[model samples]
Target: MGEKLLMKGNEVIAEAAIRAGCRHYFGYPITPQTELMHYMAKKMPKVGGVFLQAESEVSAINMVYGAASTGKRVLTSSSSPGISLKQEGISYASGAQLPAVIVNIMRGGPGLGGIQPSQSDYFQATKGGGHGDYHMIVLAPSSVQELYELTVDAFNLADKYRILTMILGDGILGQMMEVVNFRDEEKIETYDKSWAANGHKNEREHNTITSIHIDPAVLEQWNIGYQKKYQLITESEQRYELYNCDDAEIILVAYGSVARICKGAIKEAAAQGIKLGLIRPITLWPFPVKGIEKIIDIPKAFLTVEMSSGQMLEDVRLAVDGRKPVYFTGRMGGMIPTVKNIMDKVMEIKERHS
Candidate 1:
């Protein structure tokens, strides 16, 4: 353990990024996540970090593009609709293969929706919301501890792959307070940024950072290169946690706060002599398909619990691929499922399949 501190999830995320060596933060204020930017404004200057409150979400992400071009670790964050506005810059970052971290403290939305917590951004975050064939390393953290740890690692992951990484949290996690300890560890540089447009002062080649290629063939080959990197990430970056799944007749699949809710529900189910399990995907874009695949053919039913209208259920279905029955239960627009409601849904799935 390093030093223990009581902090809100959003504030911890900002501090963790700073500890992880990110010095540039560009973000616009949005509900449920404004605290993250607020924390940065308070601390970034003290740490000699650059904290710029851009005029809009669009401008903040582009500022991120600029900071990342020079190979400096940078971050930008927003809520749902604001995230949509950053999509274009995110895509450009992907095409340019720039390393940056984007935080999405999600809220309900198709247009300008509610300010309350919701996970409706599931598809947008994991499905390459921006244009072209590109991917962002997406991580979902369930608690304040994870919010801190994942934010720190998001920087490392973003730099390692030279691509955007998202710390995908919901409003509940953003607002909730918890005790977090920033563990002390030796700092070793993760990867090389030799391609950074830092400077040509030391008799080096002039490095250019761009996503555009005038020649179609060059762009096509560039896409091929990106696909190759994605393949490597897909192979090695999948993250998930299995809880009580060994003899679980029903396994709950969820992430973020929904996963924590399922944990409580599973406890109640166990008390009632029902075996319940959970598979929480920590890395959402790499989607833990292997984790689901390993549990396939286990003579069990897989039920996905979500705060959205079952966006992640599609991936669960694809992972199960008809081997076992897959069910979905969810609430929308910031409404959380009560523990009893979750237990009832579990019982319902058991009733249908049993």
Candidate 2:
């Protein structure tokens, strides 16, 4: 336990990663998330860590790959367009089964979109951003406090699972200020790297960290092994926050900054005698689909609010399994959707149900 201090979500995430034992950071400058890299530059040196501003996002992610292969804790961060540039390295890290953390302070984008917050990367983050038969452990933070906590958890989970882990946030969540409680600096656990590629001089034989498999049979075996790890993650890592769900006849499904707006809307709807509740996901990849399935019988309608066009709505539909009607409302290109706007959609859905 520790005292709370007001901090922006991006700064808190960088500080939290340091506390989680991250010693190397490589990233390019990008709007909304630039503060994160700046913070790391100043603080990492003081803590005997390395922070490098790469020439491009592609170079930054490859730097992450190099550092992570050394079994050292490493990270990279960017906005949407920058993230797209890192996809190749990201896929390489996945194939190599390297443990590393990546942060995306999402901005609107099919290409070079606006700097404002948006959840348009939902599909990219959850469905494997790069070309590959793989998935990263994607965690979404809705508040500054959760940003800190999840950043630490992201590192731990990445190390434990030996895979890439992402902290998926939007511009609003990245820039917002809130009080955050940080773990004691001395109490953070140092990762044990019995499997890391440190050095093989004094050990048995040399261990090479790579993804290239020349033999087809060996590649097939590796794929199966990786799939097994992913299955374990799916079963054990689903996380969500439920509010006022016990007797609600309608549910709101959302994540990231959109969830905060939906929270207020749910409260107002409750006051107006509307049986509305909220299901906010913390882990987007292992998405709490089972938890949602358990409550599907209670809600006649489920409304999904997102900053993207309609990415997360697809997950809601899959979770609902056609048991109830699912509706969607979205605002694109870096615009924030308001509580009133979401509530209006909720009201419309309620009326249609009646």
- Candidates in order have lDDT scores of 0.92, 0.90
TM-score of 1: 0.98
Best prediction by lDDT? 1
Q: The CA-based lDDT of model 2 is what?
A: 0.90
How well is each residue in 65-182 modelled by candidate 1, as lDDT tens digits?
A: 9999999999999999999999999999999999999999999877888988999999999898999999999999999999988988899889889989999999999999999977
The prediction achieving the highest TM-score against the true structure is 1
Clashes of 2: 0
At residue 18, give the lDDT of candidate 1. 90
Clashing pairs in 1: none
Which runs of model 2 end up more than 4 angstroms from their true locations?
185-192
Candidate 1 lDDT: 0.92
C-alpha lDDT (0 to 100) for residue 337 of candidate 2: 88
Root-mean-square deviation of candidate 2:
1.3
Error of 1 at 329 (Å): 0.4
